[model samples]
Target: MPRTVAPARRHSARSRRLRLTAAFAVLVAVAGYLTVQYVTGGTSSDQCTVESADGSAGDGRTYRMSSEQAANAATISAVGTTRGMPERAVTIALATALQESGLRNIEHGDRDSLGLFQQRPSQGWGTEKQILDPVYSAGQFYEHLAEVPGYSRLPLTVAAQRVQRSGFPQAYAKHEPDAALLAAALTGRTPASLNCEPPRSTAGTGGMTKVRAALVRSFGKDVLPATDGAGAETPAAGAAAGALSVPVDTPLRSGKGGTAQRGWELAHWAVAQSEALGIDEVAYAGKTWESGSGWRTERKESGTTSIRIQLAR
Candidate 1:
């Protein structure tokens, strides 16, 4: 039996379907936007500042990254410098990491690539375990980078490409400016530079013990005194439970720029790690970086010999 349907009713049914389809598309788009924002750390309001020690007012550059990103970037730079690699090498490594992982230690990436540099175990970079370690992955990158002859003199992108063999070699160049700035401040070439503004109420766990462990992890055991009853001061004998004083040894101070430069390097590293390590204040070289105040000149006497880190209780 043929039943005639009204034209308006038929049009109304078609219009409803079209509207539903459009609504689904809009939902998909919004979901995609949110996923991208979360992955890219766009949802965080935290900021990181990197300025030249000599820069004038308003000359500093700022970037939006999670506290985790800042901490990982600091570690990458520290590993490079610890290996005696030059600032240029550190800059290249950092720029490559920035392009590959956005300075975050990602657990997954394109084709099984992992960690900050996206090194793949199947590709002989290292095991998944090794690649996931920021220090190990960073060291591996530098190891390969050193094999590139005259890498220091080569253009950053070319040098990095020789080691990374990235599908998009040219992309590294775009990150150079920011990477260089980070390297400058993190590698101790700039003083009183690099500040991370995390939330006011946030405090990390483990205090000074964790701080020492982290220092050893990044800077190596040499940075700390021998723990086996040598000249090292036990946790009980030194400052209070919440405070850790890191003596800036002569070897660290005897580098290219001497003590002043090395002092700031350690000082700045402590400040960079503040949020991650639950550090409440870091005082070094007559300047103090408190959790809320950033870096400021201290009116009280602050000896340049040691970096005093006071953890949040």
Candidate 2:
């Protein structure tokens, strides 16, 4: 003989099983989401990675950062290079920032220290507002750095410490390899080495005018000369309403690198600024990076001479 359960009791048992299954499904879903966030390092954008072409940055030969870090680094490099500071000088600046503030434009630090280099307003770095501006802070760093005699040839820590005068002077040395890798990519010495994922949402609607203004601010007015060869304002290269193109046939600032390097430099700059400027796509040197698609080679080649930026509408 077999014992038979009551109908109500069977129903209750089935309900318990159903509830457990649903709870397990919810747990799995949460675990999957967390794994994704851990892998991407953010909910909105992917991590930025710079690879060393020459096997630098230790055995890893790669450094990964959030897009925010990459943007600050790009600005630092731009400010340095536009001042005719060599790649070595950029490396030193980057190492100092890495040690001081992890290349982030943080507002608070020890006492009055602030900004990317942890500059202290009380120590005459700048007003509190100016020190918080990435471009201004970077410019101030380079200006002080250039005054250091033979800074380019000095040891990275020595040069950086002379400018920063940090409590942890030797700290800059450990960051040198990563800083060198970033400098090579950001300075356009290593083409296509720096790549960042676009943000999930457009940051603003400032469009082409805003983008051009940012370029002039970081790379100087020559980055988009007021006049083209025919003495007219250089027009957007595309017929689309939000398209802007930067001509890189020559170095925007007189410097050692050639036009190809200049092209990649502008292309990488646009990508670094994409989130801040609401850029949808950046195309240059036959490669295109889209908001969701990172960088990919175009089936049809885009010319290498001009960097094209498509603004997010």
Candidate 3:
């Protein structure tokens, strides 16, 4: 056979082998990229980072999230806390959503499932539009989760599976560590733990009106007082135009943390919404987060009880 092989045949076979090898390499590269994206949440410009609850960043215990994922997670935490659900409940809900939708409010899933939690309207989760709304869907999830007997005491997977009834019940367990980190930051138990990068564009539709509306939508009307013009509590005196101050002194009925905790909660929420809300800076508890700079210590100690949200003009 070696003696019978022609030069042209040999070249053709070699070319075919080369093409096949190159194609395989490309396939592997694409697969690797997708797997990384799925695991890291995103590698795009609009990304977010959440450090550990203790505020240690050098330990390699951070969780990276896409801007979309951060925003959805913030909504989930807000919905739960405003409903008086504890941090554990928030952790369970977040883990469930991560497994079901990777924290994305998707429009498609297995057999008519939809939205972040992949609730199926056919199963009476909600109408398509309702299921698609993050706030509503999260609320529905919490409502279901609250009904589970001793959900707080159960294992995270057990609590989540009781609500989701997923074919893969154990899937939620793997996400617990990451979910706990997110819940800690978003729930305000971990101060300055969450930070997001500046958006690519600030020219989108934005204003304090939109910001106030988003806050009320996620944390409920109580998130902002009925006064201060847009349901935001009284603005601080001498504040600049487009600056909105959210007072955190008002105690939450069953919410976790004290005033400082609430302040950080609002601060982190603003950072998570920065890209979409056109926020330029967020200051709370003597720490400040600028659009491009992330978080910096304004002082070691201060009496700041309200979160100041500065919007880009």
Candidate 4:
């Protein structure tokens, strides 16, 4: 009457292995989610809900970007790249300040330094007014960086210091890792990666932000896009197939010549960085032009590098 019971089957090696694999996968996912939250300023999942495709003003209100500041950031990053500085350089520059100045057009710094890159005016950097100007400040940093022998090959801190000359040289080093991450996103070298949910359109700066959004659209949303190389011509202005569809007047690019062309220079430069940096296209003055899938690069015979973001014409 006391009938014997059968023993339960044990898990085979394969079953145990599967369980372990699943556990590892879950741990990895949880870790990744936490990382994104911390890096994005501990943003709530709800905060970044507005998808980039919806495109109105964006979640910009939370981050406090005016359209103007956003536009300027896009333009400046584009200019830096088209001029032939590496993506690492741009990210390092952007991150140094993202850590130090939070990307504002800052007017103050340690002692007498100022602007995004925080170059000090007291050290023969430039006048207060000049350092505060983003374009000028960025250019100055680039100029000094270019002077460092083999700078491109040097460590980020060493290369940045060749320009920054900061008292806290080590401080610049920590920023390098983050800067490298951002460089991929901001430079269009990584596409889809450099995105933010700054304050929505209504609350942020206006004019420039719209321009930046258009630029992102014209360029690929991701570092690479299907259309990137097809229509995104490699016409190097004077090159055989590189010439623009419309005839360009020589005077347009001169001090007294290329009026709109001058602005277009900035626009195209941004587009040229489409591939390696993820710039898909640039839109300005009512026209949208595509970009090459190759870092949106261009080096003119005249020693000038250029890019353009056509407006939605």
**lDDT to native, each model:** 0.78, 0.79, 0.82, 0.46
Segments in model 3 whose C-alpha atoms lie over 4 Å from true places: 1-46, 54-57, 228-238, 253-256, 299-302
Candidate topping lDDT: 3
lDDT of 1 by residue, 1-313 (tens): 9999999999999999999999998776556434433565445555566786656476766454567777888888778878888889889998999888878787776667788887989999999999999999999999999999999999999999998887678888999988888888888778888777766677756466678889889888768755655645666324776887777754633348666667777877877777788887878888888877788888886777777888876
Q: What would you estimate as the lDDT of candidate 1?
A: 0.78
How well is each residue in 165-203 modelled by candidate 3, as lDDT tens digits? 876688789999999999999988888889888665762
Positional deviation of residue 300's Cα in model 1 after best superposition, in angstroms = 3.4
Per-residue accuracy of model 4 over 1-313 as CA lDDT, tens digit each? 8965444333465678899999998776556434432443332322111112223356421232332334445545654654566666676566555544545466665556577766777788889998887677777767777778887688777776667665455666765644554444344433232222223222212232343344334332322222334445334422222122222232223233243433444443343322223333444444444432212223432122333333211
Candidate 4 lDDT trough over 10 residues, lowest sum: 45-54
TM values, all candidates: 0.82, 0.79, 0.82, 0.46
Clashes of each: 0, 0, 0, 63
Whichever of 3 and 4 has more lDDT, that candidate is: 3
- Model 1: what TM-score? 0.82
RMSD of each: 9.1, 16.4, 10.2, 20.0
